[model samples]
Target: MTEATVAIALGTRPEIIKLSPVIRECERRDINYELIHTGQHYSDNLDQVFFDQLELPDPDHHLQVGSKSHGKQTGEMIAGIEDILLDVEPEVLLVQGDTNSVLAGAIAASKLDVALGHVEAGLRSFDREMPEETNRVLTDHVGDYLFAPTETSADYLRDEGIDDKRIHVTGNTVVDAVGRHRELAAEKSSVLDDLGVAVGEFALLTAHRAENVDERDRFAELLTGVARAASSLDLDVVYPIHPRAESRLNEFDLDVPDRIHLVEPQEYLDFLELERTARLIFTDSGGVQEEACILGVPCVTLRENTERPETVDVGANRLVGTDPQTIHDGALAMTNSTTDWENPFGDGTASEQIMATLRQTHSVRTIQ
Candidate 1:
């Protein structure tokens, strides 16, 4: 077997979406990279569909860690990933975003001889309350390479006393993914027609963060607020509900408002189509916020704060906490706002830049 020169670790839909560009760049350059999937957030809809829709190659190793307590899950991932690293003996390991898989990969690679690269590094919600904040902070400190997505993120790393030499602002791969796939989504996705929603007529919603959905009252308030806002604008909310949030609704016996249309989790192209065509988007996801901004759609973030504050600074998104009245007002405010805000994320070349940086720093085998 050919020894892999680089290893990329990821375990969630967002990671898959954000890293697809990098994977494609690797393929385009004929880099010998092994893909390791931790299976941290695996489901056919959430996992397989993304790989299928994005035309990504299958992972070389899958550690079926599944769901567990944070410590248990991450610990299992570390052991499994370390074993793979030992066998593959890659020079560098790459992880993206602030998932448990990322943290585990960082810890595993840090312990081994491999250099660790954290993509979308230095993002801080600053809310220690968020598990992701802890994951990102720890991963950034241990990583040998910090590929920050924006200057704001780079500054955050500098403030944290990290060496500026290790930080490189490589725009965001989401912009690359969106640019690469939006046209494909438009041509291939019939989601709007299947959902019976017209272009520029419906609102898209996605709230699945533990902070938002684990609590019955908070989840109810979030849903109610979005429903009220959509109803006031005479628009139907098409929610591609996350499994966790859907389970909460059932467990809480929460009543979904008539104006809210709940659908199963959608494939990548379909979700991108929904975001591209929606008049507005309400989300608790950081990726969706960035995607909305990149796609030139107005967004109202369901959370009180965001790591991607550039979206707010550029008038692309509003960070309104889950209050029915406040959400309604925020929706109204964004509806009246223009979608012409400049994309704070970089032009669609982040993938190319990331690959070039890797080649410059590491002695990876590349096809001539």
Candidate 2:
């Protein structure tokens, strides 16, 4: 790589997990880079613990721009990130996933004329109602290098008129992270014993998306459906509640069934252990869907559609929105479903490919 320095910006637990492989490769190859935390998902449990569990180096910069209204949060992040870009003057600004952090990083880098590279690019739920959908679309348009996770995602980028030269078909980094961490999780996590749940005996649940959890009716319907599934199967459902979802639960005064156990958020390793061992997984999380597919677990997605259509196409996932009966039926079917499908994500070398592309292509168009 000709550039003497580069910067990778991210915030939120999913970003940390997905980006860990890239960070490690940079370190291994002795590449000059800095990690910046936008602090979009700031909290000890949500953010800090991921770095510790993943063994990633602490960030060189922390904007500390905690959560707020969408516009306020993104505006603050753009300002914070612009200041850092001015000081660091990196050759390239790399960001992962569709979050406020990714959008802020892309906007700041583009405005500063620092080449932008987006990982996990080209994914689209096509639902403009989703804030993340807007973030992904904007980031992809601004990014000079789009590291798409699959041919399907790459096709999405092409259809949007992105040139082939700028889009690279690198597999999703989540596969790389899981390959590196799953064995370690098996060795380290006691979540199963701690929660008194055995392998293949329980269902894993997570609902954090605003479309599902922030709306009282949708949230109530999701829980009711999940409860019905648990009752029918006589299987315990373990849910590691997100703080935002927990607040909504209290606000709505919704009752959780005894079969569904609500627990505090687990550390990354613990959650990985749970995801690997659970009989079936039900989630509204994009990352979780990818993880479940990679682990060969059948998944019931609590959304009308997914950006990850490959999972559904491969029979590893089923999308059954928040309809109570539909959700229950999907869970029942997935519980009896086969986990024999292939993982459409990559073979775990995505980070290396990303770094290699940046080095071999010298894709950075501007350095001032």
Colliding residue pairs in candidate 1: none
Give the whole-model CA lDDT for all candidates, comma-separated. Answer: 0.92, 0.91
TM-score, every prediction: 0.98, 0.97
Worst 10 residues of 1 by lDDT: 41-50
> How accurate locally is residue 174 in candidate 1, as Cα lDDT from 0 to 100?
96
Error of 2 at 133 (Å): 0.4
Residue range 306-342, candidate 1, lDDT tens digits: 9999999999999999988899999999999988898
In candidate 1, stretches whose alpha carbon ends up further than 4 angstroms from where it belongs are none
Q: Choose the strongest candidate by TM-score.
A: 1
- Please give the lDDT score at residue 234 for candidate 1: 94
Cα lDDT of model 2 by residue, 1-368, tens digit? 12336799998889999999999988877778879998888484568778988888889889888889999999999999888888878888999999999999999999986899999999999999999999999999989899999999999999999999999999999999999999999999999989999999999999988889989989999999988998898889999999899999999998887888999989999999999999999999999999999998889999999999999999999999999899899988988888899999999999999998998887433224
